[model samples]
Target: MNKYGRQSGPRYSASTNSAKAPATQQCQKCLEFGHYTYECKAERVYKARPTRTQQLKKPLKRVEVEVPEEFLPKREGLAAKILKDKEAERKKNKDKKKKRSRRRYSTACTHMQAELRYFIAVVVQQWKQQEQQEQQRIFTQLLFRILALSLRLSFSFAFALLLEVVVRIPFSLLLEISVALSLVQKQEQKCEQR
Candidate 1:
């Protein structure tokens, strides 16, 4: 038979209802009702107990348990300040980039203007050169015409002198001879094969 026998010991019932009776009986050490053996205050309370001779003869054993490091919470004000600083720095860098690009744009504009000025100068110089060439051609043509007229005039004057002063011929006849000579020269130049 069990130590708490069926007939002479505390009765063991199959009831699970807590309102009728507590789950666990009175503690064996404190005689208090409710709760279980592991959760009992009497079990948790430490008391001075006799040390066994086997424990006294052995050296004390040290137990090593690993504990993780605890994380400290960040200060809200400091975190906000750091975020603001980062945003300000980002804005400043963006503005600096804008300024740099603006400067580059201005420099490029100046460079383009200089190129335009140089292009205009080149065009003007070319125009001036063409005008000068045209003027030079016209002047040379005029000079050639003047020289030819002067040569013809000089020949006529020489012929007149030969007839009137040396040969003592009439002026009207000499004039007629000079006119015929000029007409013959013009016809010969016109009819000559290229």
Candidate 2:
């Protein structure tokens, strides 16, 4: 590793034995030892240049552009009138919104009163309807009770009449036995006459 650009053999060299010898660093590629990657010649060998045909054949595209007013004639009176009318309309709309909010504030008491009246009306209507319905339910229950009592009384009366008819039937049977014995004695006297 001297300034003559030649490397020494792998064995320890007598030239490097002297401590005054300059230290040598190694290159990874081509196995040369002069420089590192920042000064690599092999990297500069592959740098590409664009061809003339690639530069000449490129296409052009349209771009949108806005022209200033100074580049054209300006409308003076008509544009001013239009701007004024637009401003007036905006002011009118703003006033209308302010008036609406003011009216809302002014009538807040009346609105509350109306809401209270509506709530009371609804509550009273519901209460009245509930009372009517309850009255109807109670009337229906009373009617059912009266009908049930009449039915029970009629059934009991029918049972009592049936019992009375059963009791009278025994006396009728005794009358029938006495009449049948007299008829049989009359028939025997007629037979003896014959």
Candidate 3:
């Protein structure tokens, strides 16, 4: 069975196989058949033949012809004059280019300077703001530390005072009681002697 689940055999129709076909392959250029147009020798020879324009472009041997005196211009320094005019024109163009470039460069430089100034101002402002914020943070931390220390000191002092009162009050009362008992014993001994 094939992929579509049908029995596989010859798939072409009989009519297609029975159709008339060419007896020989013909070249499109020469129409002479064993090869295609690209391989035809006659087409290559025809392409290699030079056209009329190429034949005319071949250089002719030089032959000088004398110009009549009446047809020639009377100016003796025409070539020097042409050279001077060309040099002046070139200088003018060079000067104009230099001036234009200078103008553009100056404008660009001024704009860049202004931009740099604005950027520096912005950066300085940001730095100052950050510094102020840092100072405030440090101040707040110091203030908190000072308040905590004071609270701790006050608590420690109160605890020490309380501890002293708790210990000293009982000790003072015990000393007074012992002193009073010794004085009463001495008086009793005196009365017996009498």
Candidate 4:
């Protein structure tokens, strides 16, 4: 301890001075570290980047393979003929599917047509029923009117005839007694009595 009551070691320690490194500047033109583009005095350093094609490419490793020819491969049924037969079978399956689709479509059309026909028939039946009901109502109204007219006409005729008979009985007798020449006369001509 010093007389100032301060205990001290190396004040400027090497660790304290070397705590951080100097910040580096990169050159924009050369893309190299350690110097800015404006302060760069050395030649521009170019990074070696491998040239790549615009599209993706892969290296093909090929090796020459020697094959011994088999004479049995020249038979009638080759791999190509088998592939052709498989393609023909696929075409036949496709045709069968098309036929099934056609049959389903036709059945659907028939069903729709049947439904339409049934709907039309129902509509027609309803229309006919309504028409018949309307006709029946009109006929009943006409019949009722006819019956009422006939009853009214009969009542008017009976009342008029009774009044005539009652009025002419006395008058006819008086007239026959006064005249004493003519036979009995019928009712009034103005009333159209026949």
Candidate 1 lDDT, tens digit per residue, 1-194? 55765454334443542333365665555556775443455644455655797678885798977655465455568789999999999999999998997677567646644553443344344444654656544433433333233233333432332332223223553464466556545644553321
Higher-ranked by TM-score: 2 or 4: 4
Clashing residue pairs in candidate 3 are none
Residue pairs with clashing backbones, model 2: none
Query: C-alpha displacement of 90 in model 1, angstroms?
Result: 0.5
Q: Model 4, which residues run further than 4 Å from truth?
A: 1-77, 131-194
TM-score of every model versus the real structure = 0.27, 0.20, 0.29, 0.27
Write candidate 3's Cα lDDT for 30-117 as tens digits: 6666665544677532436577887789756789999999999987698989999999999999999989976775676466445534
| lDDT by residue for model 4 (1-194), tens | 57888756545576774444235866777766765565556776777754565223654467978766773356556888999999999999999998997677567646644553443344344444654656544433432333232222233432332333233233533443333211112122322331
Candidate No. with top TM-score: 3
| Model 1 clash number | 0
lDDT of each: 0.50, 0.48, 0.51, 0.47
Q: What lDDT does candidate 2 reach at residue 156?
A: 36
RMSD in angstroms between candidate 1 and the native structure over all alpha carbons = 32.9
